[model samples]
Target: MKKTTLLLAGLLLVSQLGMAEMKKDVKFTEKTYGVCSREMSVEVVDGKIASFSAVRGCPGNLNALSKLLPGMEVERVIDLLDDNYCSGAPLAGYTSCMDNLVEMLKYHVMGEGEGHIQEIRKNQKAGRKVVAFNGHICSGCGLCNAQLS
Candidate 1:
């Protein structure tokens, strides 16, 4: 009887430990600018991407990204996608859908980087163009200097 009781207690302790180690999934969504995609969504589990999707972007490329990004660490995705540029569209303002995804992951998921995401959202709401790079407002052009000042 004592041995059976001890075995039951051990099983309970193991179950509790398993529950403690399980991480909750987090979902994040953001609107993107200067790219074909209008919005993006990500699901993170255990600090890695569980799923990804983009709305209104290049179908083939976005589909590929959606498949490849899952199971990758959030920081690794940011590192790989940052600074991606698309020159085909002059109105893209030197940003691509992938770069915008990096921004979303940095600001929303990992909680790193400056407030470039907020600034971009504000400017987008006001129907203005915002150029950003590496979490800073782009100072290379004078168009957005007023915001800096």
Candidate 2:
């Protein structure tokens, strides 16, 4: 019983130490690609920042994330959308709907690297349309103008 108690106490102490290692002044780099928010939370842990989960969409949660990131080390931030997802017009409505909201998203990404930003464009005359990141459009989706408006 004593041995078990000692082991348990050791584990608890280690857990507390691990939790204390997360730094509050960690720096995060945010990037937006295809309606996904990619944020790289960087912090030094045991002389290096340990790896963590990839960033997805964070809606109105920037402050919370920023607070959590100070001590947490995030190695990567990736957007999950691919050419196939865009080609099917799955994001058409979102893109069109986001036109008016681009400014808001831009401000969010710029002011705080905390969430995903997506943009979509359709050009019937060119027989091609693209959903893009910032200004670089990629992947053509079938027409879905009504959904965007």
Candidate 3:
């Protein structure tokens, strides 16, 4: 499932429709905290990531994320990285690039209190846990911990 989502995101990133029109754009800057990645700036054009910049994070990993992120749909990128952890392990008990990006999109790109994420919120409020697994590889951490944040 992770592979499929990643593949789809990669394909969506390079869509011809997105590539054809680069003028229409939206820029959003999200501040990340309690983690290695401190800040991120994302520019979307035609519903796809056109440019990405990160502040105060791992150069190699952040560089790769920046490269692979552009040309991907905002939603798909969120799906791919929603549960990603820094170095693929629990660290600082905070979100990684993917999770922070989702938070940003949930409010900015997707709009406040809107879209399918609202459903997730509803379910979570109803005692359901909204989880994103990296192919079910559990990190043995409380991702669904309500006390977090």
Candidate 4:
């Protein structure tokens, strides 16, 4: 009982420290790419996309993505679209400009030293609450059980 209580206390402290480490300064970054959009700039505020723009690419698609990016968290954007390729398009060996922009943000704005996942791992190594929650189905609906399996 004593050990369990100590472990829970340690986890709570680690969780708070992880949250503190995530508070980073706002930043802006720009980069030039080889494909569709030749260049782009991204602004990050409080770990969310403040704004973004691209040059020399599909006007409609690029513009749409540019508008959608604002207010979305940068890490969420990277998880949803990184490495996504153009489907059935004439441009061979082409990936979406959105993906490229996400890449730029991850590598440039977020910095090469520590990415979102890496930070979680680093914190866990130092005893952070890397997995904060777990769920169980009371009625045995099987959805959560299937996912776990």
Q: Top lDDT: which candidate number? A: 1
Error of 1 at 8 (Å): 44
What digit string (tens of lDDT, one per residue) describes model 2 on residues 54-116? 355444444454454333222221121112232222344343212212322222322322233
Per-residue accuracy of model 3 over 1-149 as CA lDDT, tens digit each: 99999999889887854543323367978666334667789898988889888887778888998899889987788787776545442222235656666766665676544432343334334543333343343332435433221
* lDDT per model vs. reference: 0.69, 0.36, 0.61, 0.56
After TM-score superposition, what is the CA distance of residue 55 in candidate 4 from its true location, in Å? 1.0
> Pick by TM-score: which candidate is best?
1
- Candidate 1 vs. truth: CA RMSD? 10.8
Better of 2 and 3 by TM-score: 3
- Cα deviation in Å at residue 126, candidate 1? 20
Give one digit per residue, the lDDT tens place, for model 1 in 1-149: 99999999999999876642323366978777666678888899988999999898789999998999999988788789887777743234456788777777766665555544554444444555554544666533434533321
Q: State in Å the error of residue 68, model 4.
A: 1.2
Root-mean-square deviation of every model:
10.8, 14.3, 12.4, 15.5
Model 1 vs. true fold: TM: 0.60
Positional deviation of 77 in candidate 2, in angstroms?
17
Of the two candidates 1 and 2, the one with more favorable TM-score, higher being better, is 1
Q: What is the TM-score of each candidate against the true structure?
A: 0.60, 0.23, 0.54, 0.54
By lDDT, the better pick of 1 and 3 is 1
Once fitted onto the true fold, the runs of candidate 2 whose alpha carbons sit more than 4 angstroms away are 13-20, 36-149
